[model samples]
Target: MRFATVEEPDGTVRCGVVESGVEGESLLRLPAGTTVLDLIQAGELHAAGERAQAADDAVPLAGLRLLPPLDPPTVRDFVAFEEHVEGVVQSVSGGAGVVPEWYEAPTFYFTNPYALVGAHDDVAVPPGSGLFDFELEVACVVGRDAASPTPDEVDIVGYTILNDWSARDLQRREMKVNLGPAKGKDSATTLGPWLVTADELLPYRDAEGFLALDMRVAVNGVEIGQDLLSNMGWPFEELVAYAGRGTRVRAGDVLGSGTCGNGGCLAELWGRRGAQDPPPLRPGGVVEMTVEGIGTIRNTVVAGVELPPVRPARVRPRTRKRTS
Candidate 1:
C-alpha cells in the first residue's frame, strides 16, 4: 500500500492512500487529523489502506501539495555503499581504499527531523554556500519501538526516495574539526512523493536480501547518474539495528541508506576526476530523483537569506591553571 500526506486547495492537510487507475492518480482520503505515523503506531496502516481504497471520497492528485510521507521523529543516515566510500577516499587521500575498520560496522549520523522538506518543495541554498550538491538515497521509516533489536527484529514500515541536500564547502570545514555536519547538513532533507509498504518491494529483493530497485537522478533534465539499490554494502535491516543499539527507536523514525555508488553526488564526481564538472547546484536548479517501487521526488533550488558571521569562540579560559 502507498501512503501520503497532502495539503488540499483550502490549506488543510489530509492523510490518504494513493491509488492509480486508468482514469488517473488520486488520493483516497483516510480521516482528518490522522497522519501516516499515527496509522503505523496504531498498527492500522495496512487495514486503513484497504478501506481507503473503497471509499467514495477520492480526491484527484492534481493541485495538491506533497508533504513528507510521515513526520519522522528522528532521521539517522548511514554510509552503506562501499564504492561511494572508495571513490571519496581515493579522491581525498590521493590513493587509498576504504579503511578496514569501515567494514567492521555500519556508521551513521543523526540529522534534524525538523529540517525535512517535501518531495516537491523549493530548497534554498544555505547562505554563503556556493558548492551545493544533492545525494541520491533511499530511506525507510521504523514501524515500532525497539531497543537493541537484532536485524530480523527491525520493523521497517515503508520506503521512500530521499535527497540528502548538501553544502560541500561548509562540510569540508566541519570535517577538518572532526565534529559536526551540524549547520552544514541541518539545512534541509527531502523525502516523499509517498511511502510504499516494505512488502511492495519484496519482489525486488535479490536472493541475498539486497533490494534490486533501479535508482536514478537528474538535474535540470540532464541525468547525472544511476545505480542499483542492490549495490548497498549492508541492507536496511542491519542499518536499522545499528541505529537502535543502546537506544529506543520509535515508530516514524527514519533510516537512510546514505548515497548510492558511482556519482551519487557532484563531490563524488569531482573526487573521481580531481576536478569539478557541471559545477555545484545553484539557484534555479531543479533536481528530480526516482526509485523503483516508490516514486519520484523533485525539488527546485532557491536563494537563501544571508546572515551575520558567527562570533568565534575564545581559545581558552582567561585564567590558566598555574599548576605544573
Candidate 2:
C-alpha cells in the first residue's frame, strides 16, 4: 500500500494512506506524528486497507501539500552501483580506470534532511550552478536499529524514490582538495510521492521480478536514461549488510541505492564527456525519474542567485613529491 505525508488546508501535516477510486478525491489525514515510518515500525500496515475503507473523512489529495514520506532519523546515500561508480571514475580520471579503494567497501555520503522536498515540488538550482544534474535512485527506510545486523536481520521498512540533485561545477572545484562533494550537494534532495512498504515489494526482490521492472528518466518529455532494475550488481540486501557492518542503523534512517547504471543525467546524455562538454541542465527545464511498480517524481528547475565563495584552509607546503 502507498502511504504519504500531507499538509492540510489549515497548514497542519499528517500521514495518510493513498486511497484511490473514492468519489471526491482526498488524502486521508491521520493524526500528527503518524508518519509512514511509524506505521511500518509499529507493524500497523496489515490493517491499513480495513482502516482506510472504514474511515469517512479524507482531505482532498489535490489540495494538500505532500512532504517526504518518512522523517528519517539519519540519511545516508550509498554509491553501490558499479556502473555509476565506474562512470564517475571515468569522468574524473578521463578513462575507464578503477579506484582501488572503491572495491574494498561501499562508499556513502550524508545529505541534509532539511533539504528534502516532496514529490511534485519545485527543485531550485543552487546559485551560480551551471551544471545541474539528477541521480535516479531507490532509498530504503530502516525499521529498527541494529549495530551489526546480519543480512537476514536487516529490516527494510519501505522504499521510495530519491533525486540526488547535483551541482557539477561546485563538485569539481571542491573535490580537487580530496575531501568531498560536500557543500556542492547541500542545496536539495527530493524524496517521495509515497513510500511503498517492503512486504508489498517482496516479489520484486527475486530474479524474475527484477527482470520485469524498467526504470527510466526523462528531461522535458525527452527520454534520457532507461534500464531494467536487474542491472544492479549489488541488491538492497547486500547494501544493507555492507552498511550494517559495525555501524548502527536506526529506524527511519534512509539508505539510498545510489544512481542506477546509465541512470544519471551525465551518463544518459554525454557518456565520458568532460566538464567543457558536460550536458548541463538549465533553469526552466523539468526532470522526471520513474521506476516500475513505484511511481514518478517530477521537478522543475528554478535558477538561484550566486553564493559567496567558500574560504579554503591554509596547508603546509610539501618538501618533496612522495612516490608510492
Of the candidates shown, which would achieve the greatest TM-score relative to the real structure? 1
Over the stretch 1-324, how does candidate 1's per-residue lDDT look in tens digits? 899899889999998988898888899999788889889888889999988887747998878999998988889888898888877665434556788988999998898899889989999998778889899999988998899999899999989998998887787778778776777788999999899999999999888878999999999999998999989988898888888889888888899999998788777787877787768898999999999899999999999988997788888867766866
Model 1 scores a TM of 0.95
lDDT of 1 at 211: 94
Q: Look at candidate 1 and tell me the lDDT of residue 46.
A: 95
lDDT of each: 0.88, 0.75
Which residue pairs in candidate 2 collide? 26-60, 27-59
State in Å the error of residue 17, model 2.
0.4
lDDT of 2 by residue, 166-194 (tens): 88777777778877777678788899878
Angstrom error of the Cα, residue 245, model 2: value is 1.3
Worst 10 residues of 1 by lDDT: 87-96
